[model samples]
Target: MKQRPFARLRAPRSLAAMATAGVMALALTACGGTTKDSASNSGSGDAGSGASASANPNAPIKEGLKIAFLPKQINNPYSTIVDKSGIDAAKEYKGEAKEVGPSDASASSQVSYINTLIQQRQDAILVAANDPNAVCGPLKQARSRGIKVIAYDSDTNPDCRDIFINQASSEEVGRSQVKLLSELMDGKGEFAVLSATANATNQNTWIKFMQEELKKPEYSGMKLVKIAYGDDDDQKSFQQTQGLLQAYPNLKGIIAPTTVGIAAAARYISGSKYKGKVVVTGLGTPNQMRQFIKDGTVTKFQLWNPKDLGYLSSYAAAALASGQITGAQGETLKAGRLGERTIGANGEIVLGPPFTFEKSNIDEFDF
Candidate 1:
């Protein structure tokens, strides 16, 4: 029997003020890591350099494939929702999906999980890496054992994984964050970034683009005072938001690129003196940011549907495990209901551009 595409696939959309003219061509860089098997070590190199890269396309897709999802941290609301989407996708594919990871978002936390997955002989491992370089060693070992390694949301070094599912264009997300904050602040005043963690690959990449975007003449009046780390912790983000307010008396706004950080910052501002004075904007789900937007604590924010991100990642993992496509440039995979996705440069598949959720359209989204 022919299989239909994965269920609950939705068309990707762009928000009114969020679409950009062009995507910046950002070069992929190699991250550092040491592996046990130095002879077959996969750290950073061309496609087909690793054992998984050379996996045969005709190889049987493991039945009831065990796919382990390792997010940065367990029990995180955002991670929980996204990982659930992956698990649902696994069920649709007749595969088993399990969630495993550290409770805290730290650079080295995911190493143990990867080692455990290797011991269990899982077919594929889907991860949103906490640190790009930290997980490469264990991931390389997993690949050596013919395990399909795919990174999603947050990515590891290109050499460590077969493919990476990017939630959105990093450059676009970073620029849009600055654009949204600049608009809210009327193109001027001090702003700070409340990021997830210092070593987070995606967070650092977006922050880099934000800094680049700030150099434009239109944003000359805008100043970035500080970039704080919340480690994707609710309390840490809340306290960081408070610290920003205390440290920068004239701060006009904050851009928290992580879902956790943004939500926590909003919660802080909603109950604090900074409410209505300091605008909060960044990546957050509609349900989490809905009240903040309705109460005027936050005017706008951006995010791709994380559930969809996980869904796509799951399909991609299945495709790889099934040996339908290699992680090569120009290779295409049938992404269930989301339609076909082509591999871009550096074995990356971009889900789509992010959507800005404002009060007008925030209610239209639930995830």
Candidate 2:
């Protein structure tokens, strides 16, 4: 029996490494080193560097064909959903899909994990990068070693990966969360944003779009007083939330788009004396925010079903790895049980629309 490891895949770094190796292989193909072997070892630190790159792109994989699904954090519900999605896909594809990540979404830690997976010579990798550019170098090397790479939840440099499995349009995710906050505050009030790491691509993109959307006339009265970074640490998020309360005595609402930040903030608010005075809104798990919603600490919050996100991400990765979709714009692919997904111009696969959670329907979910 082939044993699977606990750690997830590292797609961005692996893809980046592959690209770098491809360039070097092209130059060294005539110098005794085979293009196939050099390409496979580009980013992967694996000793097996002489594999044929000309092997069928959609070759039949085996039961032990390893595919890693690395997220920002393994314990967070948001990332857990992504991990589960990849897991489900691996099961269907007759292979191993493992989940691994840094404890606090550290870029350096992610790079280290990528190096380890390359050394293992895993078949493929799927990742949600912490720092986009930082992961690219390692990913390029993984690609050089002939390992398929897929980016899901967040992207890396396009040249580094075969496909990027987007949960939803980044613009849509940003607009949706901001729209939820607008509704919670009735489009008028002093609101603050509690975001994740300052360098996180997904959060920054959403925040930028939210800021842009707020500038429109409809949200003219909604003042975004401050933006705080929690680094996705629970204690830090709690401290930041408490600070926000003290710093903005007149603040009416708080929007925390990152799962860890929002849940930590919600816990602080729910346990505080000022619970009813302020509204908490953002992306969170139904299970984590259930009590807050019931006690009126947070009237409502929003998040898409994470299990579904994971399930779809896995399918997208497998399809791309197997050459089912060419990772081209304007393409479409089928997601088992979830129906068909459209491939946008940037090689992104939109899973579906985002879903919201409130007191009225919070009990329907467990994670």
Candidate 3:
């Protein structure tokens, strides 16, 4: 017998509704032969004309459009799940979807993959940038070759990508983590952050917001002891967790906003004397954190459905590739099952709020 976690105030709407409602109708008016002008440009379509002036002007209105997803690293559990969901969405639209990226989360590793996708003439390239500026050059080249560039999960520079599919509001996520940690620590004592790579755009943004949240009077007794980077590696994060305990014997809690870092920290604490002594909480999938919660190592954690994030990103990419939306602020487009989404400032599309998972309900979710 398993218990369901209590519903948090920020819980997203039923994902079951999106999965069961089925895929949206594919608009086929944009199909058939490519215009000679578009075909003449090195087998890829012309950036200025084909991308902006297709007959349907909304895609993927046609079949055979190739969309590629580049995660920060290959074989990562979180990235694999998210990219596979995107592939499923592409198939629903009768288009081909490919996942390609380096094995490690290096800043420059994604650049070569972007260039390869451009040469392959992919219609769209969706990326989770390892570093914001490192991949901008290659992504700009992809755009020049008529490939619609969209950032998902993690973002590149604004000038490099046409749109960004953000998983959740960074400010909200940061504040929520602090709120959870405060409750676990009794609103006082010292805590540390176990983060991903130091240069990760999303991690840094969320950390900045967490720093701001700490300024509130309620959290004044909650001192931030240190910030440690694990490079999103399991072994490194475990070591960092051990180091945190050794350095700050009075540390009362740890907030790890990255999936990899949080899980690693939990694993370390679960097997050590720190278990029950230090509270661990942050963003994590239920499947990954279930045992931790059951063992009293982690009280709670929060995250949006990664599958839905990928699904929305896939549709957003196809919409741009088919010219349905131009990534403008205030432009709106429909995403299959998830409903209509608007392009917010900085060409961003928010999926929704993160949900809290605990022993009462961690068993209810599989992703």
Candidate 4:
């Protein structure tokens, strides 16, 4: 009497045999189900498959995409760090990053790279432009072709590029350098500025801002005697600094906004008879200006970490590529470990304020 539930309803001899076969056939049919619904229910499903694939443009665009980071020059340490940080950022996204730039910071050379990136169909170009508007035409072409253009360290025209990654605000850099120079000179002296090429975007901006700030009553005693261009060349900067000394015999301080100019001036002052009489300061790096600082030729200088600039630039580029940001003014972005910063009106992201370095803390930073 311990019969199975369906076993009690035994079929007629032939019908029972047919029912058993029918049940077996149904079981097999269920196991070998080929319905669209079944296919969707299995491992290889169609649930949102088409929509998901089509919704993400960057997912496909990012695969095997290449980004180029073109600096003003390949030889300079500052640009070298830019190149390195970009490569590191690309590695995280499984992308390709390469460096292409002139060895001498020529505008024509940078233009060539812009053209090359366009021809290669690069995904994005992050450049530290040699001259503003010089590479605009090619960068505009890149934009038309769906390639994103970003400027880091220095910027091109806003209409030509998607974003500019500024190491710090132009005014902050200018004021910080002026303050450093004033501190080094004890708040009163005739000082000359050794800037980069006259057309250089960053150097000119900072110099102008510094000149305006020095006119304030708090800095009225400090006289900015002259603004000279060194073209960012070592020999030229050295000669320019020396020329400033000759041109202004009473010059008590020198502010070289260009790293090359600043370091060259420091070296020149250190090797000359005016070593202790004149203090050299500006945007030189810790490694390059360390000896001069130790020797007392450069008592103080101001700069944001160059590596941080590179790191932030790469992160911003990634954000743009991933469609996380559009480089719009007032948009805020987190530059890696450095906190959030709102994009400026110029489509630039300012890294933050610059810090002055003197004997007390110059030794703590390596570059």
How big is the RMSD of model 1?
A: 8.9
Q: How accurate is candidate 4 locally (lDDT)?
A: 0.70
Cα deviation of 236, candidate 2, in Å: 0.6
Off by over 4 Å in 3: 1-60
- Give per-residue CA lDDT, model 1, range 99-147, as digits (tens): 8888899999989788877777777899999999999988877887667
Instruction: Compose the digit string of candidate 3's lDDT tens values, residues 242-299.
Output: 9999999999999999899999999999999989999999998877898999999999
TM-scores across all candidates? 0.86, 0.82, 0.87, 0.80
How does candidate 2 fare on TM-score?
0.82
lDDT of 2 by residue, 1-367 (tens): 2112111222234311111101110010113222235533433443112122222334443455677777876666667655765575678768777776677777656887777777766677788878777788878777767676778777877767766877667888888777888887788889899998877777888899998889789898899999999988899999999999999998988889888888898889888877887888888877778888888888877766566667777776666555455566665666666677777776677665666777766765566
Better-scoring candidate (lDDT), 3 or 4: 3
lDDT of 3 at 149: 88
Better of 2 and 4 by TM-score: 2
User: How accurate locally, in lDDT, is each candidate?
Assistant: 0.82, 0.70, 0.80, 0.70
Q: How much lDDT does candidate 3 score?
A: 0.80
- What is the overall TM-score of model 1 with all chains considered together? 0.86
